[model samples]
Structure formats: structure tokens, C-alpha cells
Target: MEETISLQDLFKTLKKRLALILTCMILGVTIAGVVSYLLMTPTYQSSTQILVNQTQQEQDQFTSQEIQTNLQLINTYNVIIKSPAILDLVIERLTLDMTPGQLTQHITVASEQDSQVVNVTVKDPDPHRAADIANTTAEVFEEEIPKLMNVDNVNILSPAIVGDNPQPVDPNPPLNMAIGAVIGLMIGVGIAFLLEYLDTSIKGERDVEEILDLPILGLISPIPESDVNLDNVVRTRRKRR
Candidate 1:
């Protein structure tokens, strides 16, 4: 026969295994906290902004075809900024120990839609190194773009500055711990229900009756000492006769 469990039964099951669930949750969260603190590496990020304009004048060049041409080339410039040709020079200028590809991996170039501004970001383990990389990459790109593209269109709008106290970007402890706790709780609940489902031992008289499908004739209580002695004497007399 198919058996269906109700909400009450489910609650009862969880209540019965609440201790196990709580233990698992605590252990899982503790492990997660410790691992997050010990095994995770911290990363720092620095960013600089560059403006892509044909001339240094502050006037709006909205109607100029040259401005539109520069806008179209912004995408190409964004790609070139992360290429080996540019990053290689930046690496040599800075005397960095990393390869061109490695430097490229740490750099990001982004530009807004219909805007002439470009944002460059660099991430590293050291805050100062991150800032230096951002600044140098922008500088090299500014110096090299004129010769390569025949247009001095890139301008360093802002350079990356390190504050008195820089913040780490990766290994966010609170967020990691929260996610770990949630995952642990889910696993704990799943394990609790799984154990309950696998348990098939009879726990009560109702279970026995249901399994046997027989009438329970009677249930007797223990006899008193006097009644037991009287029954023994009667049995002895019957044996002698």
C-alpha cells in the first residue's frame, strides 16, 4: 500500500531529529568560517578613468563627424588597451615580474554608452601594486595610442589613488559565512528527513497491531503474592489427586 505523510508527521520527524540537525548545522558553519579565514586569498582593486576626445577643448563636439569617428573607435581602443603590445610595454616600464597575459588578466577596460569616458580597473593582492598598475597602464595607453592609431584621442581623466586605508575586494567573510550557513542548514534538514525515512523499526503497539492484523485478546496485570500462593497450593492439590 502507498503511504502518505502529513504535515504533522513531518514536524514530528524533524522534532525527533532536531538534535542531529542542530549539531550538523553548528559543525558545518564552524568549518565554513575557519576555511574562509584560512584558505581564502584577499584581493585589492584600483581604477582610473580616461576620456576619449579628439581635442583638449571643453566644448561639446556633438555635431563633429570626427567625434563620432572617435566614439566608434572607442571599442577598438578598449580591446587594444588589454593587448600584449600595450601591456608588454607597461610591464617593462614598471619592471613587473608578471607576463603580458598576466598583466592583461588583472586589467579591465570599460566605456559607457554614447559617452567619451573610459574606466580602467586593476586588481591585485597588494593595494599599492594595484594602484601603480592602473596608473601605469593608463599612462602607457595614453602615450602609445597617438603613434598606433594616429589620433591623440585618449586622456587620463583620473588616476588611481590609494587612501590611508585601502579595502580588500575578495574573500568577503560575512557574505561567505551567510551562504555557508544556509547551505549547511539545507544539508542538515535533508539528512534528518533521509534518516527518518530509512528508519523502519516498530516503535509502538499500534505498529505491531497494524503489521499483524490480529485482535488483541486481553492485557493482564501482575498478580498479588497472596493470589500467587493460593494458585500454587490449588495446583499442588490437583497434582496429588
Candidate 2:
């Protein structure tokens, strides 16, 4: 016999396994929260801004061509800021124990469209060191760009700083917990449906009829205790006679 389930059966399956589903969700959230907050190392980020402007601007007059040229140069400056030529100097100055390529992994360079400003963001486990790396990279680039391109165009605009208390930017606890909850819910629902699908036991009259593909002729009721005792007594009297 071919067996198929209805919507009512599906709902019943989920409801019957509701406790297991809730347990999975709660367990997922708890584990994610613990890993994010206590087990994983957090990274702090700091950013510094550098301006690429023409050093020899005429007195009180800035030309549109000069502004456009600076805007175009911002992209080149963004690339150079993360290059080994710049990062090597930053490493030497800070005495950081990492190669230029490894240092590049901790730094990001970005520039706004049609703007002459570039932002260098650095992330590290230590907040103060992150700020120091951002500021030093900007300073080293400011000093080196003139020699590299034979133009004094780079200038530090805003330096990164660490306050008395700094916060980590990575391994966000709430976001991790939310993701875990969604994944756990999906797993729980899937498991509930899977268990239901794999079940093959007959549970009631409807299930028996569906499995056997036959109609029930009649129902048998259990005999009462008093009636059974009276029948036994009659049997005993007949036997004695």
C-alpha cells in the first residue's frame, strides 16, 4: 500500500517533537553566545584619514583641474598605502613582528568617489596597537610618497586614537546568536519531519486500514469482571454436577 501524509499529520509531527526543537534552538544559542563572547579573540579597529592635495596651490586660488587631478590620484595613493614599500617602513617604526604581506591583512585602504581623502583602517587584538599602526602607516606614507612620486601631495588629516576604554569590533555576540538560532530552527524542523517520514508503525484504526487496505467488519468489546466471574461460577457448577 502507498502511504501519504496530510497537513494535519505534518502539524502533529512538529507538535509532538516541539520539546526537542526548542532544546536544539536553546542549545545552539547558548553555544554560539559562549564562543563569541568568551572563547574567540576579539579584534579592535582604528582608522586614519590622509589627504592628497597639491602642495603648490596658487595663493587663494584652487583650480578645478587641480582638484580633479587630486581626486584621480587618490586611487593610486590608496594602493600605495598598503604596499610593502609603505608597510615595511611602518613595521620598522613599530617593531611589529610580522611580514609586509601579513601586515597588509590587518589593514584596509579606501577612498571616497571624486574625493581626495583616503581612509586607512587597521585591526588588531590590542586596541592601542591598532591605533598606533593606523597612525604610523599614515605618517610613513606621508613622508615617503614625495620621494616615490617626486610630489609632496600626501598629508595626514585625522589620526587614530584609543580612549581610556576601547571596544572590540569583531565576533559580535548578538549577531552570532541570531545566526545560530536560525540555523538551529531549520535543523530542528528538518529532524522532526525526517523522524516522521521514517516512522512505519501503525498507531490507530485509520493507520491499520491504510496499511492493510481493508475495511473493518466489527468491533470487539472487553467482557466485564462481574460477567466473567458469573460465567466461571456456572462452569464450575456444571463440572461438579
Candidate 3:
């Protein structure tokens, strides 16, 4: 026969092993807090914007063909902005230690649907460095694109500026700790039930009857030593009488 557990039994099991569950949850939260606060590195983000148009007059010359051409070329421009040709100049101007590919990996170029603005974002461990990278990448692209594409379409819309209190974009300690605590609680509950299932020692009359397949005749009450001594004295008095 299959064993079925009810809500009352489940609650009893959890109640019996509440200490283990609580301990696991507390340990998990402590470890998560320490790791999030002390071990994880924070990352800061900064972004700059660049405007893309065929020419100052191209806005008046809006057509399906012109839009398609511009969209197709935008991907090429995105690639070129992160290329060695542009990033090398940016490195030279900023005197950065990183290689072109390393700098490129930190940068991201994005454009909106049917919009002429391209947003360039950079992430780094330092806020100021992130801002500098963003601004420098934009400026370098602005200067290089006009010469390479032979069109003065790229213009700096907004330069990346240092934020007053820039926040880290990564290593959300509170969120991480909360998630760890939840996982730990689940693990603790699982372990508690597993131990309860593995326990074979009988603690109740029902367990004893079920395991041994015998009816309990009677239960013996334990007598205290003081009571036994008083009974012995009473018996000796009766004998002397």
C-alpha cells in the first residue's frame, strides 16, 4: 500500500524539525550577505548619445529607399564605432591601458525603432572611467565617421557627464541575500523531511504498535526514589505491628 500524508502530519513533521530549518535559513542568509557585501565587485554604467542622419537636409528627403539605406548602414556604423580604427584613437586620446577589443567589450551601441539617435553605453568598475569611456567613444566616432563615410551625418547629441552620486549597476547585495535566504529555507525544509522519513526510532504508542504488530497491554508509570522509600517504610511499620 502507498503511504499518504495529510496536512496535519506535514505540519507535525515541519514543527518537529523547525530548529534545523531555522538554522539552515540563518546560515544561508549570513553567507549570502557576506559574499554579496565583501566578495562581489560593483560595476558602474555611463552613456552618451549620437544622432544619425544622411545629412541636415535628409530629414526633408524622407523616403522608403532612404530609410532602408540608412538602417542597413547603421549596423556598419555600430561595428565601426567599436573598431580599432576608432577605439585606438580614443585610447590614444584618453591614455587608457586597455586594448581595443577590451574597450569594445565594455561598450554597447543601441538605436531606437525609426529613430535617428544612437545611444552608446559603457560599463566599468569606476564611475568616472565609465563616463570617460562613453564620452570618448562618442567623440571618436563623431570625428571618424564623417571622414570614413564621407558624410557629416554623425553628431554628438549628448556627452556623458559625471553623475553626482553614480550607483553601481551590478552586485545587488540585498536582492542576492534575499534570494539566497529563500533557497536556504527550501533546502532546510527538504532536509528536515528527509531526516524525519529516515528516522526509525519509535516515540509513540501508534508507532510501536504499527512496527511490532502487537497490542499494548498496559503502560508502566515510573516511580520516584522518594516514593519507593516511603512505601518501604510503610511496609516495615506494618510488619513491626
Top candidate (TM-score): 2
> Cα deviation of 168 in candidate 1 (Å)?
0.4
Q: Residue by residue across 99-197, what tens digits does model 2's lDDT show?
A: 999999999999966677889999999999999999999999989988988998778999998988888999899999999998888889999888877
The per-model lDDT (C-alpha) reads 0.85, 0.89, 0.87
Per-residue lDDT tens digits for candidate 3, residues 1-241, read 2456789989999999999999999888899999988998889989999888666454556778877878888878888888999999989988999899899889998887778788899989999989998998888888888789887788888999877888998888888889888988999999999998999998877777777778999887889999999999999999999
* lDDT: the better of candidates 2 and 3: 2
CA shift of 162, model 1, Å:
0.7
lDDT of 1 at 91: 90
Error of 2 at 210 (Å): 3.4
TM-score of each: 0.79, 0.82, 0.80
RMSD of 3: 3.8
For each candidate in turn, give its C-alpha RMSD to the true structure in angstroms: 6.0, 4.5, 3.8
lDDT of 1: 0.85
Error of 1 at 46 (Å): 0.6
Clashes of each: 0, 0, 0
